[model samples]
Target: MSRIIRNLVSLALLLTAMSVQAAPSSFDLVGPRLSVAVTRDGSTLPLEWVPNLAEGDRVAIKLDLPAGQSDRFRLVAAFLRGAVDRPPDAWFHDTVSGKTKGGDLSLVVPKGAQQLVLFVLPERGAGRNAIVSAVRKQPGTFVRAVQDLNQAALDRARLDTFLDLLFRIGRQDPDSVNAASQVLTRSLAIKLKTECLQQPPELQAACLTGDRETLLFADTHSSALADTLTGAPVDLAFQLSATPQGGYGSYSSYIGVVRDILRLFGAFQSSQLRFVPALARMGDGRLTLLLNTPLSFAKPASVMVVGLPAIEAAKPPPLQAAAGVPLLCAAPDTVLPVEGAPLVYATRYAHDMVLRVAPDGAAGFDLPVHADARRGGFVLDRALPDRSAGATIDARIAGRWGFTPFDGPRFKLSDPRVNRWTAAPRASLVVGRSNAVTLTGEGAGCIDGITMQRGDAAAQAVSWKQDDANTIVVDVPLDKATPGTVTLTVTARAPAPPVSIVLPALQEVGRIDGVAYAAGDESAVLTGSRLDQVREVRAGKATWRPGALTRAAGADRLTLLPVDPAAAQVLTAGERIVADVTF
Candidate 1:
């Protein structure tokens, strides 16, 4: 053979080998059928029907090898404790040499092992280190393989149940169809549009069977659905209409239509069911986890957020999962009762929602939170100091299928700091009207105390609400006020001095007695008692404020522009437009 021919042959062989390696693994072809059985109350029973197993349970691994492949292959079992990167030998592992066809191998589940991974490799290089190294090199591959297997197994059970219901309906059982209706409604976490449900009783069913089915089903090729399913949950802005269609005709046909629709939904579920986690910063500075999962058909009964530290990084500061506490700033009084770190939330059938966690003050955690393989539980982390800043923490999201490493958002260790408060009084004290006062500054949303008083008398009644991040609106009722100077004081989240504003007697406040406007003129004149106190005036829908003021004989005069000309025209049309005068 010539040298050139040999080189060509070698290049062809190299490409073939590369292609083989790059080809994706088919979960079915690499067949080593396995089943788990747990020992409960001294009786070892097969758990083929069980969807999940808890940590620290003693289990037997039943394996069945592929045809003509046995003695050369060995099964390596990795009981995963947490979604953290570790050395090949750092994780717990057990092996069963494929000496015989396939037999039961017994092993105890380690504490905190959220999942178990099995690798069937050739015995020659299948040492513990080699197997772990191969598993670690492609962690996502190993995890996803098991995750897919679990999801498929779950889907199989669901398919069987659905098929059984369909078979009963075929047997002329009308009640079976009604029973399946509830199941079909819960098949997807996404909600139907309000319009679809708002139809009259007779048209309700027709509405769902109409072209409006897209309101509930998103388009299979929609980029929005693809994007939403790929990453953390985002605020869905577009309408959903993918993948499922509304079935027309008889009510029984609707059942078959839903069955087909659910089939498509299941395929979507299999493709997009990612158990990864994403972090979001809530409005009030609280960090939240948005786990990307909850299959359209099989939503999780509960979710857990596990905090794990980096293997090589500095020791993580103490942290806590504030379970059952409401993030007042972000969600206000919505009490989210979570378990602990991994903070477990009993969220059944929730496709995506914000989960808030806080550190526990009492019985805090330590570094290196892990799922214990032997002890059968988790070792959580501790709470950081109140002033701790720039501290980093790692997190993972765990569901029924499995857990995945998640990158959490950076958060501050303390509440928002307020430097000062500035008050912009929007209204004056009128004897029989409500006054609005606007306060703007840092920590404006944290107003807990506010009061109004006349001289040194008792505090007057006032109500205030945070309008935004740096603004607050306070309503002061002057229905029972006597003529006197009223002082307003506000206390907020910050420990600074209380901000105060003073107002003159209610009788001294200005009033708009009459508003004068000329046809086609841009400005309007207001004549009223104490006109100097009047800051703004409204004629119909148009707002007019004094720009230049002049005092005439026994009267105060001001030039004001009608900001809206169209509304000013309504005034010229003799519309009974009310004049609103405010300080």
Candidate 2:
């Protein structure tokens, strides 16, 4: 096994040496493989995707199998495009029976092997397994592009977020920031009394439930009692605040209240730090998540933050986001400031954009943000005015921002407000015939590509035109949908080198095509073209879902029985593989 893995790794290195950040020399990468061919004899199972090997060089093989099904098959790589004899299984499995699923596996290609295959029937009962999907990860045209697109959305988000934080922080209005220290403390102390109590108290059960002010006092310094938070009651958590030896005096005073903030919610900073739930409020228009990590004399950084509220808030706002339920105001006009002596803020990405807000209140973003500036950072009308104490920065930025793809093209897609990188930016779709939708990104030329689908049917790009430099309108022919699968498109020559766009799944509201059984002993080929096997052929149609059937549902033939004799009569047939619904 070690030798086999080593040989595969060596092959990848060899390919890299021959090419620049790309796939192997002789092979080409193929798209996803959801279909499988299981020979009647079960001697071999060939994937829809064969390793690309029109050969200019040598090759090896890699395979990924469905869970708990690896033992049912053995790996074999083909050579000479079948001109020469194929090699044996590259490595031997401990299980003589290929029935259990193993993770991804690789094999050594023969000196002349160009493609890969699997011998499925190691044993008689082994025909019950399959491969979910496989790609040789070739070094070709789209490899780098796809990798870039993957990170593009993420990069855009960080950059936009960084800009949003910078611009919003510049507008900070400290005067509007009312000090809630006393109010927060009293509220925390009262809330704590209602939800919690001290263990081994000198008083009886209801003793400390009402007089929350005293309970707050008793619990605050309960170092004798404040030892462990392991006593959180159901739906309630335990929190305590302790003042370090040298700390902010008033800030130290409310340490207990702030401690609750540290406990209930996550920190405003990096994922590395953790914070508990702290309650701030949705004051009229502003929705805030407030937690003040006390800045000492040494680290005297103090600034308030206004974050997008939780997806679902405890109470509704006057202006609800989606439903009547109140949501975090779309984009709070507040920028995030680095929490240190010298404030630093940058896009979430490692690179792209960075802004330095000097403590003296001067702020500068990496690029001049002009509203109509194409290919520039988040657009602003004019260069920002330097801000000072309590500046009220309303960074009203919007949409899914992303970075540029690597080594691909000069084109970039940002400002999700108008052109988002997501598949379903519209958030809704209708199925039956075809549906038209727009894709947002930055590219040089007219869009010449699209990918779409509804239910079992796939969609094709019927017509497309460049809406502008940043937007392209593409029409897709959608099929009648039950639940539309995610539709993706690879638009060639958008900004030039061609880019792929994955729209959100066009969620279709339609009927379910469940596999219902007829009464009696029966064996029939399932309706679909390429199905291997299904775990349960619905015994009775009792609220079944697609998930009820596992991935190995590639087998064409299925055998089923009725859950009840009455249901048997309702279904009447042995195997109703095909549906009788009107199209």
Candidate 3:
């Protein structure tokens, strides 16, 4: 029996050497560059060759399973480090028969292992399993495995894939058992407090029972106690309880309960959630939520009741309104500085007066009642001297003053009289009834001279012509004098390039005395120094008859007159100046 054992051991050693010698080259040992093929069952398994792996090298074996299969399958890989005794870094259960599902799986191998083993299983049952086997390579096989797996990691490696998928599925199909489990895990992990958990039987239900009322209370009173709570701006107004498919109240109420619970739980985790269920107002009116505890770590206990007055009702009015006062005067006037103590009359009486007076004695008053009186009916009873009486009686009676008096009895003391008595200069030019024949110079400058029309036909009319240097003068008919003021406009030419006229800053010259003046239906007089040399006296384009021009031969003035009366009558309104001057 001893001899047989020795021979068997030698045979085993020979077979082991042959197997090692039969190992493929580094290129062949590392199979297909660790290509990952995702199976129809959603397992992403990597098949790679371990090159030159010695009998005692420690290595990590990574088996990547599809997103939802990591927790369900058992990962088994041979020739790996820390495989037999579970290592802290190992992501999969080493003793499990199949691989984990719901995420990617990884395992470490113990030394002296020859082949790698991997097993993948479905999430729920034990039947479906994907098996992967890989050969161990010599010399830095562990590092190579890690490198190859790192590249393949993207194929099945996602940190929150399972969680996100769980959420998506749960939202879509809340009744799914897998989705429920996922949601429960997520909720528990995040420590979310749901309204579903807070309700007590049917009576305590968030949506069905009066939980919605409680939520509304929290929202309306959020501003009052927001500072004291951990979370604020809680959007409790949205009908979160109602699902799209469910009836209005049913869906919103249900979702609202869940959302509220989540908010509360979020607050609890962040140390911010404050539940001070008091009273709050809705569009319909008020509601109350009874918060069981002042502050507690354990789940909150609360109840809701409709038609409760908000906490704001218990507090006094806001501080801003405290300063407001009701005023009581109608048509109040500001007190002004006067030489004498003038008795001013009020337009209407006030039961109580509230005045906001400025430093300058300008006062604004609020009226207690509407005034029903008309204007100018109430007058001030004050005496004035004959000289002081010249001061115009102009008064700003505050209560809707109009031109006409009111039909009611006049209040003599109600209207205030303002005295303005200052002498002003009389106008040089008056609008009505003047006997003097006024002739306005048209065109540029002031009128210098005037001449009377001479000839056989001129005796029939009273005609006095004015001489405006290089301009026309308006000839106002003295015999048939008009009552109103007649405006005579002259063509005021802008000065030549070298000459600029500086207009008087204080006084506006209404009409230029000379140049070319045109009045209604009367002959205009054009007079200048070189009147006879002017070939064409054109206003705009049409020619004008030359008016009498005084040609002085050594201080002897000779008047050259217009021979045509028809040409003089052609000059009409606006600036009538001679254009295209020849001389």
Candidate with maximal lDDT = 1
The better-scoring model by TM-score among 2 and 3 is 2
The TM-score, computed over Cα atoms with residue i paired to residue i, of candidate 1 is 0.32
**Which regions of candidate 3 are displaced past 4 Å?**
1-354, 358-423, 427-583
Worst 10 residues of 3 by lDDT: 338-347
Residue 318 deviation, candidate 3, in Å?
Answer: 16
At residue 104, candidate 3 shows an lDDT of 33
At residue 350, what lDDT does model 2 achieve?
14
Per candidate, the number of residue pairs that clash is: 24, 60, 52
List model 3 lDDT by residue over 1-583, tens digit each: 9999999999999999998665421110111001122121222222211112233233333333344533433333333332233222232233332333323333333333333323222233222111111112121332233222221121111112223443454456544533243232222111122443344333222222122222221122232442243223333222122121111001111223323432432332212212222111111111112122232323322111111110010111011111221211112331111110000111111112121111223332222212111111122222222122111121222321111111111111111122111112331222221123333222222122232222212322223333322223234333333223332222211221111111111211222124444444444444444344455444443444544544233121222223354565555677546444344
TM-score for candidate 3: 0.15
What's the lDDT for candidate 2?
A: 0.28
Off by over 4 Å in 2: 1-191, 195-241, 245-363, 366-418, 421-583
TM-scores of the candidates are: 0.32, 0.20, 0.15
**lDDT of the candidates, in the order given:** 0.41, 0.28, 0.26
lDDT of 1: 0.41
lDDT of 2 by residue, 295-387 (tens): 111221121211111111111111101122111111112122111100001111111222222233445232222111111122223223333
Cα distance off (Å), candidate 3, residue 459:
45
Please write out the lDDT profile of model 1 over residues 1-583, one tens digit for every residue: 6999999999999999998765422112112345555564464434431224555456676545556764544455676544454423545455554554444567666555566654444455335565565556555444433443333322222222333433444356443343332333223212233453454444443443333222222222333543344322222211211211111000110112222222332332222121221111111112122222331222311111111111111111112333322222211231222211111111111111222234434332222333221121223333333442221122222222111112222122212233246665644565544567676665553356788887778986588876655566778777566777778887654444577778765665455557777777878888755665677887657888776766556355767776676777666645466777787
